[model samples]
Structure formats: structure tokens, C-alpha cells
Target: MAGPMISHSPAAPPRPGPGRRVVLGRRVVLGAALGWGAAGLAGCGAGREPVQRLRLATGPEGGPYNAFGRALAAATQGHAPAVVPLATAASVDNLHRLDDGSVELALAMADTAEDAVRGRNSFGRPLPVAALARIYVNYTHLLAPADGPVRTVADLAGRRVAVGADGSGVQVVARRLLETASLTGGAGRVAEVPLALGESVAALCAGRVDALFWSGGVPTPAVAELARELPLRVLALDGPAGVLRARYGPVYTAAEFPAGVYGLREPVGTVGVGNYLLARTDVPADAVCAVLRTVFDAWRDLLREVTAGARLEPRFAVSTGAVPLHPGATAYYRSVYG
Candidate 1:
């Protein structure tokens, strides 16, 4: 999978080729499209009932989650249960809100979702959250100045690193990667700083931090803009990918950033994690089904706003791994496959 690198050209997004499953590196896209109309969607346990107002927990401002959330909210302008995007710290924070009934929906990294459901890592207890869909893959980006002293993961030892904002999936993975490189736990520990995507960019440009970690869809707008302002390279984490997967599970996939992204002459290896659309168990099944219809039906319009939006596929959408599917989502998928 490609890391977040903004595209400047008007190149068309990739579509499924001939086969039933089109393999692109570690990800797959279904050739069959879910082009069902309103009548078909109504049969998926909801019978055309309008959905209620729902608040979706999205990431911090200028992040992929927030951008996609706002786009989705706009798509539901005429639909019921108007989806309001709630700007948050992403992943862990979103999950907490879902558990506490602060929000009805969320976008979270699969790794973080797994942790919350299992009551491990960032969560203090098991959360009553379930998957609506495995939305897209998020590439882990370890960014550093192109002409800086740090060239590899090992070089990050004893240096300051912006490990994303508090209660974010970026921080969870960043700290673990540091631990894997033996850059934490002792004298060689990295000086960790928590900052949102925009803040991290500014800090890096001002030399306040040596590196920053971000996990988002390919060509994240903020990251792309940062690249144009300052020359930086995404550090490779191929070796650590295996370690993380071995320790945490298959949530972490070994992937790479393609050449020409961020103007790189070569691909940079990194870890990839699936991003899931989630909802609390208390969310009504009909409402969840309606939201799924909105997401899958309006994907092309969403594509114009976020690249991850273009990745909405039937087969790929159902792969939530350990996170169990919401009943409404189950009904929606059954209708599609049937």
C-alpha cells in the first residue's frame, strides 16, 4: 500500500481489473461492484426507514478521518440522522467516546480497535464497540528532514519525536516502534512529544523535533502539504513491521510507499494497518444499515474528497478481522452478497 503522499496530477484512481479480486500489494479490491439502488438497500433489515441523527467521531483537524467525516456528513444532507463529524484525537479517543455513548460512530485503526475490544494497551476495560466496515488501509509514516542527522529508525535514539496527539493510534504504534528499535526504556529513550498532524509539521520545520509519526490514508493532505514546504523523507519500518505483527497480531501489515510519492526516487518500506468504521452496540440496526448504504452508495463523491473513500469495496469492506461485525452491517453485507 502507498503511504500518505498528496497527488498533484489528475491521474485516475485505480479500479478493479478483470478478476473477482484485484490484488494491489497487500490489499485487494473486488471486481464486482455494489451498485444497488434505494429499493435494494431498503430490503436490508430497514425497509426505507429514515435513520436518526448520528455523531461520528473523527480525527483531529486537518487529518484524513476528519476530512472523510465531513465529506460523509455532507453526503447525508438530505438523509435522516444527519451525521455530524465530531473532531477528536482519533482511534483510542474515538473508541472511548463510542463506549461512553458520546458518539454513535467512529473511524479507528484496526490495531487500536483490537486493543479496545480486548481491553489491552490503551483501554482500561473492554469496550462495547463493533465494526461497521473495514474501510481502508493506513500507512505508518515516520518522517524526518531530508538533510537531517537521523536517517534510520536506529538513529532516532535519544532524539525528540512527535508521536501524534494523545489518545491516537499514531501514538500507540509510534511508542511500540520505538520500543522495538530499543530506543525507549532506558538512557537511549526517545523524548516523546504529542502533537496533531499540523502541529507536528510546524515543529519539524522549526527543528523542535527530530521526527514525527503519522498513520493515515495514502497522500494525506497535511503530509503532502508539509512535503512541499520542507524536504523530508519517510523512514523505512519494514523490519519493525514483522516484530509488531508478531507481538500484536496481523493488524500490522508490511507495506511500502511507492516512488514518486512525496517526490521520492525509491519506495520506502513501512507498516500498514486497516482503518475500520465502528459503532457502539447500542446503535440501532436500521440506522447502521442506512449509514452503510450512504457510505457505499456515495463512494465516488467521497473519492473526490478523500482517497480512502475510493477504496470502498464489497469484499474488502467485510474484512474486519477480530472485530465482530455489527448486526446492521451484517444485514447490509448479506444483502450485497446475496
Candidate 2:
């Protein structure tokens, strides 16, 4: 069952465009890998005239959010009215944008969305957010200069680092990783520079920053290409995990970066977290249902971005712990399971 090739950002890789062997998450793709039986969205909206337009918030040009968002927009062309993929800071920024009514639906890391919903950490206060789906796992990438003084997280201390822009999932994860490594700046030695996802790589390459922490799918095009141009190394997060999980919820999972990814000399041990599709709690149930129905109905279309998971089952869709599932999504899941 092949289909049209989706044109994603120019910054990402050129091969295996969407429906290849690219794998993501604890299980895999929510579309075919999960073997979801699509019954169409006809039951989602019922008699409604259909939504007119929708705004989707994704990460910068070279990240997963942007790639998935475009594929999503294409899938929603007729079903969701109109979906517009807008590039933002990713996760934290996307939630804030959704909170402020700038975008109707946004993609975010589960941990960041939990913080926004509970008004903790980088999130200023409690926000009204609901989860539509738990998509894939974003492995934390702690990239450093190959020729620099960094081998482990300890070396990040006293270095100029790019920890994503304000209101971004990268900021949330970077701060937590630093805390996990017990490297929250000794005497304010670590200079944290916040930059947009589109800017982080360039800054590190130009000698503007020592390293940049990123959370995304494997072989993230920008970082993969950057490794070829610059001597880069990934730092392993082999530190205490229980404390961070207890403090930040169960979003973080133990994961490994394969040895060959980004041309690393050896496999880097890191953490993995779930990325989610989030929406406002105020959105109509049927409208939300319609959107998700289209997602699953057209799940195959998202194959390029939401790589097929290996062992995950569609029944695990509602497993997101903190963020409550959107009624529409729940309804669709109910229909799928029941």
C-alpha cells in the first residue's frame, strides 16, 4: 500500500522519506505498525459541516514536529477543514501558543505538556491542555564538539550551551538533564544560551556554543548532517534517574542511541520521552474526534514522520499518565477497542 511522497522541510534527510524502515517509540508507528483498522471519520463529525481551518504548531525547520505536522496537515486536508503547520519552539512553545489561542492544536513532549497542564517548572501557571494522542519517543541528544573538553555531562559545566528557546521542550529537558547530572552551574559557570530549533545547530557549528541538547527521532537530519561537517560527540545520560522521574512524572524512559547514529564512536545511553498531540480542553468533542478519526483513518499517510513502532499496540493509546485524553480521542479509542 504505497502512496504519495510528502514534501517535508528541506533540512531533513532525503531518503526513506516517510514510509520506510524508520522506527520510533517504545512500540512503533501508530498507523500501520499498530495495525489500526480505519473505519473513516464519517462517524466523527456526523452531520457537521466540517471545520474550516486549523493551526498546528511544530518545531523548527529541521525537527520532528515540523515533519510530522506537515504530514498531518496533508492528512487533514479534507477531514479537518484546513490544517496549517506553523514552526515554533516545539513542546513548551507549542503549548504556550495553544494556551494563548495562537494555534488550535500543537505537538509537544509529554513531560513539557504535563508541566504546562500543572503549572510547574518552565510553565508559568496551570494551562488548559488535553492530549489527543501519544505519538513517538524522542530520544534525548546531548551533542558536543568532538574536539571539545566534553566527554560526559560533567563537562557541560562552565561551557556555553544552547538549551533551546524559551517555552520549548528542549529547555525543559536540558534543564532536567543538567539537574540529573548535578551540573546546574557551579558558581554560575554554565552559560545557557536559548535559541530557536532552527538556530541551535548553526550556532554550535560556528563556534558560538560548546554543545546543544536536542530531543528528537533518530538520525535527525540536521544533527546527522552536522556530524559530517563538524566533529561531534553525543554525551550519555548515565546518571540517577529515579529522582528526576519522581519529580518530573514518568515521561522519561531509559533509552539508547545506537552506535552508528550520527557517526558516534559508540552507542550513547540516553533518556526517551513521549511526544504528544495536544489540544485545548474547550475544543468540541466531535470536532476533536473528527481530527483524530482522520489521523487514524489516514494513519498510513503519517508513516514518513511517525515511523512505525515495532511492538506497541494501538490499545496503549490511552496510556499517557498525567495529561487527560481529549474526549474525542477517547471516544475514537473506545470505538477502536470496544
Candidate 3:
């Protein structure tokens, strides 16, 4: 049974432009001397302050957050503090871990981070966490088979859908999108299954699920792999994107999956959210400064490993919206701009 053709809005917000290329050149030298250089960061080096082992909460095994986190951990070895990446549900889980003192650093979507700091949605009260940087943009991917009956958001009614794991950012966006489309809760509820990215991909391929919601970078490895095995379509989501923005502030933006992504013949409009690197408010300023310096210094290396065209520019990193910058991060940025 072929699904109805999915058509995207012509006015879909233009795909987010590429990361502005900044020529590091001499700045790299100055930055290293004052910020992340081996000699400059003596506090993190041997024979100075004992190297602090900071637990960084990353996403599930096959996700971008996990990949980026691990790469960062590797980049900081023998230089900055020993960063240890812990695999967990992405975004929401990472923030919760940061709040509970289980993690010193976390990566989270801007929406979930805002909820935590504002005491809305999943969080009971304002959490004491701060942003280290806004690392990249995440595109909300609502995927279904090209041959399946599910075509539009409205078609998800009564369908078995993988809405991400219990403590993940994907679930947060999935529920809201379903509700806005009137396909969730009440009598028309979707059969929501909480599965991690890998499990969700397996479920969809095996016919255990009609569709799945994933919020990550363009060309998510799992989604691309699924496309090769079975024909698929990323549903157009311009309508839901508007509704979400009207309800929330500037957190949600209309974005599109470019043609050739996941084998799509055309672009698909969806939602976009910023991915932020966060830290527990209590983490030492010098430690956070060192980590930020290391990230900025080693960004190109990190970019090569991370997918979805992730960027790590200082200007982009500083645009964390409502999330307050950690004091250490603040110092690092000051050094960069000065």
C-alpha cells in the first residue's frame, strides 16, 4: 500500500546556512597561549592540580551526541581534564544527570534546556545548570516507509510509533508534534513505544513500528541506513512547526531536510532546535574554561567526526539563547573575542 505523496511547504524556512567559516590563523596561536595550550592550562596538566575526571552525558550508542562526546573526550586526553563520556538517553536525560550531579557536562536541545531552567514541562523546578556552548542545530526527523499507509502527521492516528526512549529529547518533540496534529492522547492516540535510536531503527525495519520520530542532525546514520534497506519518506512538518513556535517562543524554527538526504527526492520541512553543551553550575570555572578552550582549539578535528555538518564557531557557540553561560565559559569567550 503506497502512502499518499508527501509535499513540503514552499515557504519552509530556508535550510540553515552552513557554519560561517572563521579563519583561525593567528588567533589560534593567541588562543592557545591564553586558553587551551598545554603550557597555558597547567592546572589541567600533570604536576599541577590533579586532573579532574568529568563525566560527560552523551546520547545512545549510535547517535550524534554520543559520537561527538566520545570524540571530544579523546581530543582532551593528556591535555585538558580527563573527559569521560557516559552513554545515556540524549538531551533530557543529559540535563537530568547534570541536575542530579551524576554528570559534570551534558549536551541538550535548547527546548529541553529552557524547560529545565524555566521549571516547565518535564522539570519540576528551575534546574541549576548553565550552557557552555550552542554547538549545532538538530532537525526533527519524522520518518515513515514510502510504501506505508502513514503519509502525514494526521495519518499517525492509532499507529505504532517509536517516540524515542523514556528519557530522551526525541520523545519531547514527538509528543508535542503528535498532539498538535491531533493524533496523540484521547481516542486517536498513537501507540507510543519508548525505544532508543538503535532499537527504534530495528523496530521500524522489522515492521514492529509504522513510523519513528528522531531529532538529530541531517543524514542521521540510523535513518540513512534504514533508507537503504526500505524506501522511506520524511513527512513534511511545516504546520506543526508553526504551532509549536506560537506556543513556545523562538525555540522551534521551520527547517527542511535537503534533497538527497535519506534518499528523499525533494526537501521536507520540519522543526529545528539548537543543541547546547551544558555544565552543572557548581563545576569549577577554570575546568569549564579549559574544556571550552580545548573544544574551540580542536573543533575542526571534532567536526570531521561528527555528522549533520556540526559547527563549533565561537559566535555560534555563544548563541545559547535563554540558557545562561557558565562563568568559566564566559571567560573563555572573552579571551577569544579580545
Candidate 4:
């Protein structure tokens, strides 16, 4: 009478064997797969939209533009969308990509971007694009060895100089500056050797070349390393200061590299242009907003990551001459400041 009514029949079919347990596990796995498939279909129809992918074209490896591109990729990884960075030839090439729909984003020198959008200077046709931000300034430095006699731009006459590789922004500006200084004549020669930055430094140190022109961000690693090991002098281009400013529309500014800033004995005054991020006009507004948000939000983190990042600021983003702001980026700027 005690447990007659509560007795389980035959111990409820005996606990399942290992084989039965295996079957049960298989059923669970199958059921989970089906449920996930259904949820995914539902998500496609009514849930969050799929993440968008963007391709950012940057400069040559080991350059400021490339470094910034990498930082941008890291910053936007966990964001709503995904961004991909493509290492390419510097500013001019990047502009071409933006125009042809080859890339959604690009890192370009402000001067180059200006030229592209207005069909002036390097760009032969008007390119439809907009600026996302001004990330840094590319200071044009004239690198000469300590014992070399090329003290100033004037002294470069009758001397060999490496004006960077062909199609490089360095070469374009170097030629312009040389022309302005009257340094390009039968007596003076420019060797168009397409060498990497490291190789150019070595060539200069070895006396194979008298001078090299480099347009890049402050604290450039190649220049810094060369300055440390060898006695180097960055010639102050003072002869055509007024001419460059007048011709280039004031986007060109006279900036000083203070003594010890790059192991220099005295401050060196040089001309420079700001660097900015460019995007094709066709990029979605939402994507542009996401990119701008990521960049400005992680500005501090980026500064710590790259030397050039320290110059990226909201105010600088709007300080451009020819490059117009993208509507999305302008919206973000107004939201943050106003």
C-alpha cells in the first residue's frame, strides 16, 4: 500500500544506453541547425541589415598614409560595418582610384586632392570626390649629408639629387620647387632613380647622391634614422617662398622644424601641405558617417599608434583650399562642434 500507486513502470524503460545517448545528441544537433537556419532567414528579412564593406586606398607601405590606413582599419573593425585597406602608390594614384570607383576611400595630400577635384596640377580632369578629414601635414624636407656642399636650394646647381621615384608626389613637388628656385638647368641634374626611402637614404649617405627631396609627415622614420647616424642638414628653401605661396594659393604655408625636433642644430623653415582623407562621391552617406565617427572617436588612440596621427584634429579637417567636404563628414563636424 505504501508505494503501489507511485511505482514507476519497470523503472521507466531503463536509462538510455550510450548508443541511445549518441542518437539523442545527434537529434539535438540537427534541431539546432534547423533553428539557426530559420533565425538567419528571419534576420535577413526583418533584423539588422548586413554590414557594409569599404575599401580604403592608401599610400606605399611604410608611409604615413599607409600607417593611418592601418589604424583606421583597426578602429572600424568592431563597428557597424567593415573597412578594408588597400596599400597603393601615394596621393596621386589614390586620387585616380577614387575617381574611377576603384576604391571607396583614399588618403591623399591636400594639394593632390585639390588638384584632382579642380582638374589642376597633377590631375588632368575634374574628379568627383570629397574630403572626410585632414589627417596630417606633409612637410617637404631637403635631405643633404653633413659634409655635402648643397647647403641651400641654390647650392644644388651642378649637383646630383634624387627627386624620388617617378609619379611620386615627392618628384612632382620637388620639380616645382626646383623650378621656382631656378635649380633645374643644364648644370644641375636630377637622377630619376626609383628607389625606396631606405635606399635613397643610403645612396645619399654614400655620396652617390647629393640631395633627396622627401615630402612626408614630421618625425619620418627614414629621415629621423638618417639624422641620428649621420650629420644631416635640411636646407631652408627661402629663395622662392613668396612665389610658391602665391602660385599654390596659400595652401602652402611656411612651417618651422625647431632645433632638436629632428636632431637639427637650428630650426629649419620649409613649405608644406596638409594631408586629408578622400572618398569617392558615390560612397553611401551612412558609410561615410561611420568612417568619420570612427576616426574622430578614436583620434586619441590613433595618435598613440602613429606619429602622424597627432596632427589629426577636427579644426584641421575643414582647413582646406580646393578640396570640398563630403556632406556626411560636414554633418558630423557640425554635430560635434555646433
| Model 4 bad stretches (over 4 Å) | 1-51, 305-309
RMSD of 4: 21.0
Q: Flag the better candidate by lDDT, 1 or 2.
A: 1
Sort by lDDT, best first: 1, 3, 2, 4
Point out the higher-scoring one by TM-score: 1 or 4.
Answer: 1
Give, for candidate 3, the lowest lDDT window spanning 10 residues. Answer: 1-10
**For residues 69-157, what per-residue lDDT tens digits would candidate 4 score against the true structure?**
78878888876557788988777888888888888898877667777888987778899998877766667888898787877887888
lDDT of each: 0.80, 0.71, 0.78, 0.68
Question: Sort by TM-score, best first: what order?
Answer: 1, 3, 2, 4
Q: In terms of TM-score, how similar is model 1 to the real structure?
A: 0.86
Candidate number achieving the greatest lDDT relative to the actual structure = 1
RMSD of 2: 8.7
Q: lDDT per residue, candidate 3, 261-296, as tens digits?
A: 889888788888778899998887678878987888
- Flag regions of model 3 displaced more than 4 Å: 1-51
Candidate 1 structure quality by residue, lDDT tens digits, 1-338: 44231211123334545544333221211211133344324435645556668999999887888887998899888787689999999998999999989999999999999999899878888899988887777888999999999899989989999999999999999988998999887888899999988999999999999999998866777888889989887899999998998998878888778787877889888998888999998777678877888998876675554553345666667777778777677667655553
- In the predicted model 4, the residue pairs found to clash are none
Query: Cα-based RMSD of the predictions, in order?
Result: 5.9, 8.7, 7.9, 21.0
